[model samples]
Target: MAVRLPILLFRMGLGPAFGKRLLLLHHTGRATGLDRRVVLEVVAYEPNAGSWIVASGFGTRSDWYRNLRVEPKTVVQFGNRHHAVTARFLAADDGADIMARYGRRHPRTARRLCAFMKLPSDGSEASFRDAGRAIPFVRLDEARPRLP
Candidate 1:
């Protein structure tokens, strides 16, 4: 499928082609218990905390989103580097804040993301907030190795 093209690229070690804007999420299927992969647009990258925030444009129905909810500990690929991470489901308020910031930083891309999700946005902060409230965001924080 056309949608799986990114996944294939990631598999081929061409993930660097997508740069920092896109990351490959490797999670386990909640029902099937099989490995699954999805490429999601990075809504925000927190360098200080080594976390990557992403939104579920399809809402809670997205398999990857739900998968992470069940198994917070997973791995993600940014370019060719893979890191163990823990998923943190953000609250609606946090989503609103991130969405607002994202809109301000990348207006055109934000509008396109909203449009793709069929959310009406006039490029106003309020509209972005509304869209954020409707969408679910997850922060993937890098997992720290446990000391023995």
Candidate 2:
């Protein structure tokens, strides 16, 4: 019931309003072989590279993270834009830097996110680095358009 609501809204085209802050991930379940969808917060976006950095707040055990490991090819919807992407796991140091940068940009939200994830963050780069090491980060690189 909870998940259905956002999926409905995203499908209705309200996604763009959230911009790069939120995205809908469409991935295949590794175990069930069924399609699955989830909404995730975008920690950062590299416009030059057409990539987004996202973290597995629920840790490495998150179904989506696990699923992506099995099948890296996926699609993400941000606002009204849909992009085919390949998910790549980020190194612990890189994830830490991403988190630190995100905290600087959105302090309140970052604090809430850390709290929700049961991660401790003192709003310092080092503290965020510690938390980053405990979780998993992935870079979703947008696939280039295919030429026919």
Candidate 3:
């Protein structure tokens, strides 16, 4: 119930209030073909690429991660702004780099995230990189319209 609070806020058009740190993901159930929504933390935002990087704290076992693998096309709402996007799984190397940098920027949050994911973190670059390699990171890139 507490986890759904953010989704409710998003539905109330207050999601953007959280800025780029959090987003509401509108996805589909692969097997049920049903619309579903989840709020995820945005680890990194690439302004140039118009993409947001997020990680599955529960690794590949996460249902949202599984659903995204099957249907990458989806919608992401960063507060008031919504975009048509596709989910791209980042490589382990990229994850390592991102995690290392993220730890540098937000040491406490990074450590907390690692703990939540059941990954040990010593607040060191190598530890963060190792944790990254173990987790599943996804990039939600703004999808370009197909030429008709």
Encode model 1's per-residue lDDT on 28-116: one tens digit a residue: 99999999999999999976678999999889999999999899999999999999999999999999999999999999999998999
- Give candidate 2's error at residue 6 in angstroms: 1.9
Residue 55 C-alpha lDDT in model 3: 93
Taken over the whole model, the C-alpha lDDT of each candidate is 0.93, 0.86, 0.91
Ten contiguous residues with the weakest lDDT in model 3: 139-148
Compare the candidates by lDDT and give the number of the best one: 1
List model 3 lDDT by residue over 1-148, tens digit each. 9979999999998986898799998889999999999999999998677889999998998889999999999999887888899999999999999999999999999999999988999999999999988889999999863343
Clash counts per candidate, in order, are 0, 2, 2
- TM-scores, each model vs. reference: 0.93, 0.90, 0.94
Error of 1 at 71 (Å): 0.9
Worst 10 residues of 2 by lDDT: 139-148
Q: Superposing all C-alpha atoms, what RMSD in Å does each candidate have to the true structure?
A: 2.8, 2.7, 2.9
C-alpha positional error of residue 13 in candidate 2 after TM-score superposition, expressed in Å: 1.5
TM-score of 2: 0.90
